[model samples]
Target: MMQENMAGAHLIWMLILALVVVIPFWRICQKAGYPGILGLLSIVPIANIALIYFLAFARWPAHKSVQQDPSS
Candidate 1:
């Protein structure tokens, strides 16, 4: 049925959209020394906003390591 095909197409489109949004955030989390799994939160409505604040205010492990280095 056309409706069945549309549903499948919708699911695929949403998955692609999620990946487009998540992959960059996932990479950012990794680079910031946070768990990349945190990027999965991007798909959640309220949690996504909270995640942004969490990322912005949270102390990054990468920065801590750099600050602790004697060469710096």
Candidate 2:
């Protein structure tokens, strides 16, 4: 029983560790123009696993059209 509890605790810690590394990096990706929820897709199987890799290393969209200032 004690060993099982320890194993559960270790699993939780590993998940927390992954989230700690992913969340802020995800936010940065969002600010750089990717959708923020793209991080959540990282949890999906197969295709999403690839998506995560792509998002992690992919170039964020930096040149999308933006509204111009009327004062310009």
**Leading candidate by lDDT:** 1
Worst 10 residues of 2 by lDDT: 63-72
Lowest lDDT block of 10, candidate 1: 23-32
TM-score, per-candidate, Cα-based: 0.95, 0.54
Question: What local distance difference test score does each model get?
Answer: 0.95, 0.70
lDDT of 1: 0.95
Candidate 2 per-residue lDDT, tens place, 10-68, comes to: 99998997787568757865876877777666555675677667866776574342334
- Residue 2's lDDT within candidate 1 is 100
- Clashes in model 2: which pairs? none
Q: Write the per-residue lDDT of candidate 1 for residues 1-72, one digit (tens) a residue.
A: 999999999999999999999998899899999999999999999999998998899999999999999986
